[model samples]
Target: MDIGILLLGVAVLIGAVVVSATGGDRKIARLDRRLARVEQKLDAIAANLGVDLPEPELATVKALLAEGKKIQAVRAYREATGADLKEAADAVERLGG
Candidate 1:
């Protein structure tokens, strides 16, 4: 029946969308790994050149830390720097200390 064919078409379309989304996720993961490697290399180069990378100055984050709002500081750092949660938390802790 036509209904069966329509159902099959819809199923195929859904499958295609899922496949594409999965592929995109894999590509993003690969890119993230590549970017991390590049960052490592850049850090090494900077170290060899005796270049001290200046820490980013985030006034809001600093103020939050000073006020004993550690969680807010971490969240602000992550928002400003696009860093992961763990990285933001660690950075906030260091700044607080």
Candidate 2:
């Protein structure tokens, strides 16, 4: 009878932990969505204000640099953000090239 009670307590504890973990995951997912929305709004506002945005998410630029295409990367950055050659080169340099 004592063993049965102990096992039951352990089961309850495990159930509570699982429930808490799943709750945390849901909260994190919700926060991620909110963050993405905010970022989109901010990017739009920045564009209207003629502020150049970073291109860490510019996959093609990253790929170009990775494939030994610094010039192409600079061009891509320029095209994407309407940056000047010097600004584009600086941006590409921050990509570790």
Candidate 2: list runs displaced more than 4 Å.
Answer: 56-97
Full-model lDDT for every candidate: 0.92, 0.91
Model 2 lDDT, full chain set: 0.91
lDDT of 2 by residue, 1-97 (tens): 9999999999999999999999999999999999999999998999999999564457889999999999999999888888999999998999866
RMSD of each: 4.7, 10.0
Query: What would the TM-score be for candidate 1 when compared with the true structure?
Result: 0.66
Q: Candidate 1, residues 1-97: lDDT per residue as tens digits?
A: 9999999999999999999999999999999999999999999999999999777679999999889998889989999888999999998888872
Point to the candidate with the largest lDDT: 1
Give the winner by TM-score.
Answer: 1
